[model samples]
Target: MAAAVFLVVVVVGIVSAVVAMSHRSPVVNVLSLVVTLFCVAASYALLGAEFLAAAQILIYAGAILVLFLFVVMLLNAPEEQRPKEPRPFQRAVGLLLALLAGVGGVAVLIGIEVVAPAARVSGDARAIGRLLVGPYIFAFEFISVVLLAALVGALVLVKRKH
Candidate 1:
């Protein structure tokens, strides 16, 4: 049952990601990205990482996706500006590269030995908090700084446009 739910979420996330990347309208792309994020959160939940699932929804789906949509709306970029198709040569090259990468990834996965699951610490919010503050402190601080910079940059850009 959990595996079935995970599979569905994975499929949805893939479709949403493709739609987000291929869409011409910024608004629609942002909406698709939000859907992708939500599906990923659901996948995390199905994997028993409830804390990560909640954080994924709260941070990416709720905050970042909303910010992206707000920026897209504020910019009011015309749909016509988006490229509908790549050059033929670019498309060919991209396809060839994708095929090569996929082949290599499959080979690597097939070569890996299966391992039994190790005993895991309970993944409660408290455990997550401890890990974040201890081992991932630098990453946490770095992300906060990056977000702050992005906010300042957005404000500056909007101010200049007005």
Candidate 2:
């Protein structure tokens, strides 16, 4: 039962991610990404990492998604207009590339051999917190700085357009 649910969550996550990337409208992309993020959280819960699941929902689904929506609205980004007629040549080339990529991915997967299983690590909140503040503290701080810079850039762009 758990495996079945996990499979469903993973499928939904993949599908939603594809939808998010394929959409032209920013609002549609955001909505699809929300679905994808929620599915990811569901996947973590299914894998018994409840702490990670909760964090995924709270951080990515709640805070980051809201921030994305705010950025979309602030920028007043318009939906891209689709071409009146589809280009068959472009579609054919894209299809051929996609097929080639799929073949390469399958070949790589088949060629790879695992010597030994990786060590299982704890996913508890305390352990994660400790790791965040421990040797990875610089990485954590760097991410925060990057996010801050992005927010500042967004505000500047908004102001400049006026």
Candidate 3:
């Protein structure tokens, strides 16, 4: 049952990612991305990473996706922008870069051996707080700053046009 649920979440995540990438409308794409984030959070929950799941839902699905949708609506972006075909050279370069990334990821995965799951931690909130403040302190602060900048930029852009 757990395995089936995990599989379903993974499949949904993949489908949502594909939809997000392939959708022509920005609003639809953002909605698809939110769906993807939700699936990711579900996966995290299944893996017993409750704190991570909540963070994924709160930060990515709630805050970031909402901001994306708001910006798209505020700009009144067109539903169907003309797609640009990449030049041959650009396409070749992109393919090469993608291949390199794929190879690197495969190599890393092969090098790292999977470990069995440890006992699940209780007090998820406290654990997450400690984790964020310890090794991930810089990342937490960086994200906060980035979010602040995005908010300020959005306000400035909207205000100037008004």
Error of 2 at 84 (Å): 5.4
Q: What are the Cα lDDT values of the candidates? A: 0.87, 0.89, 0.89
lDDT of 3 by residue, 1-162 (tens): 998998898899899899999988999999999989999889888877888889899999888899899889999988786679889999999999999999999999999989997787663788889988999999999999998998899778769552
What ranking of all candidate models by TM-score puts the best one first? 1, 3, 2
- Mind giving the per-residue lDDT tens digits that candidate 2 earns over 62-104? 9999989998999999888886775999889989999999999
Clashing pairs in 3: none
lDDT per residue for candidate 1 within 3-80, as digits (tens), equals 788788889999999999998888999999899989988877766788988999998988888988888888888895
lDDT of 2: 0.89
Alpha carbon deviation, residue 89, candidate 2 (Å): 4.5
Worst 10 residues of 1 by lDDT: 153-162
Question: Which candidate number maximizes TM-score?
Answer: 1
Number of the candidate with higher lDDT, 1 or 2: 2
* Candidate 1 Cα outliers beyond 4 Å, as residue runs: 81-92, 135-158
Poorest 10 consecutive residues of model 2 by lDDT? Answer: 114-123
- Model 3 scores a TM of 0.75
TM-score of each: 0.79, 0.74, 0.75
Deviation from native of the Cα of residue 36 in model 3, angstroms: 0.5
Q: How well does candidate 1 score on lDDT at residue 50? A: 89
Candidate 2, TM-score vs. the true structure?
Answer: 0.74
